[model samples]
Target: MLYTNITSINHFFITGFPGLSLEHYGIVSCLLLVLFLAIVFGNMFLLVFVKCESSLHRPTYLIFCHLALTDLTFGTVTLPKIISKYWFDDSIISFYGCFAQMYFIHLIGAAHSFILMVMALDRSIAIYAPLRYTVLFTNTSASVLCVISWLLPTSWMVGVVLDALSLPYCNSNIIVQCYCDHIAITSLGCENVRDVHIVAFGLAMFSLLVPLGFIIISYFIIIVAVMRISSAQSRIKTLSTCTPQLLITFLYYMPRCFVYLANNVGFTFSVPVRIVVVMLYSLLPAAVNPIIYCFKTKAIKDSLKRKFLVRKVNIRTKT
Candidate 1:
């Protein structure tokens, strides 16, 4: 038994996402598998394309590569457990297992938020200082920024995990979500988690809300700057470059905001609604990221075409 009364439920049944039925597991599994592949392969392709294309060796794309890596890590941290839930019917994670999941989820999530902020900063510098962009965002500076982005989140997550673990879960041990989310797990505690809630909320604001605010402000400034440019063609080109990023930002930020709001306000949706929200939050960004890159950037599309054509030619030659 994982919990004694005032809790007494050891291992609660986690129904995959929020509303997914056992009868629909096969369909959900197929959809999720497709999404998983797209997220993983898409990010990998972006990373490789950036590396192999000499023309793409700039500060902007460098940050994008890092962003892709972070997205890949973030998706990997959450989706595997979701897949397992559908495949194995095993939703019961142990106490320690739950803690570990929370740690990595928060870590990658914070890293994702930080990377978005960095990307916004990169854009700000690029738009504001075209001539000095290279000098301002050198490889060394970018590398340092990336390290800080990763380390800060790592430290915060470690603290959260430690604090959560220290709390006595003397009541129930069942996590509501398919995976062990910190907010969901903390809510199950029998003891007062006021301090824990405060800390978690603080971190969420710092990691998610702050970065989101920065991105919005950065884009606002960017739009103003772009509008002031007298050349219509140049303005169009600038807007085009920013559009893909804006789409990504919208998709990433809105669902996260919903989830955080839901957690904070004690907004209780039905199981299906909750599952949809969580699934969208976890999966959509990963799925959309690659598609955005592939469609928005000609360089990636051309490279993929070349690789596919080369493979086709080789197959014909062999036959």
Candidate 2:
């Protein structure tokens, strides 16, 4: 392997798993197909269900709808090309195509983080100021926040994407990770990418930590408020309402921060372990969110039963 640069290598090969054998590619592909379908149907169903159900048109449900869209987009941006790579051995992604993928991956990822923070804020407000929650957080307000979540990340990621794009890539066009992302692309650059990564890291930290900080504070206030309740049953009941979101939030944040921190500080992970960790945190939250965040709600559960079971029984009786 002589060091001759491809000067303008138009495509980068996605190494599905650097360590995994080609024989196992299909198996991983099948699993990813399942996860992708789950993410698609799960989030899409919630969005469609929200649209069709008049009862679910409120700000609370709108927040979840925003999250559903974010998760849906996140999975779509990362999954298909990788699935194609694993299943069909089509690993080539054009320079701009990779750029688009990298851009959206970071943007959607940041949006998801901020959206989760919004959800935490929504919960906090409801728990801490029940009476004022309705007044303080309205449909208009939630909608605005949702728009901001999608837009705010756009500005932060654009510079990073542009920096990576401008840099000259060498002969090797192999991306270590499953997808084209800021870090993956920057690492391929022939330039000194330390500053770019640092800037990206700073922006990433701000996007993650600011919202995370708020969520933590919001939860703290919420916990304090919950504890003040005199009835043990009521306290348990209130905390029960929060468990699902808290669970998803933990899944969303902790692993991502760990991976980011590891990448920046030069913490070494086996390639397989690193990719698997990335995929789990990235995809699992999206896949499980519909179940944990949406369907777990009593209203949605009852609606499901009415829409399916009741309708089935009615048809049977009519027949």
Q: If scored against the real structure, what TM-score would every candidate get?
A: 0.88, 0.94
lDDT of 2 by residue, 27-56 (tens): 999999999999999999999998898887
Global CA lDDT computed for model 1: 0.78
State which candidate has the highest lDDT: 2
Clashing pairs in 2: none
Question: Candidate 1, residues 90-201: lDDT per residue as tens digits?
Answer: 6766667667878888888788788788888877777877789888988678767877888988887888888887776667665667677787888877789999989987
What TM-score should be assigned to candidate 2?
0.94
**Residue runs of model 1 more than 4 Å from their true location after superposition:** 1-13, 18-20, 258-268, 302-319
Report each candidate's C-alpha RMSD, comma-separated, in the order given.
3.0, 1.9
What is the clash tally of candidate 2?
Answer: 0
Clashes of each: 4, 0
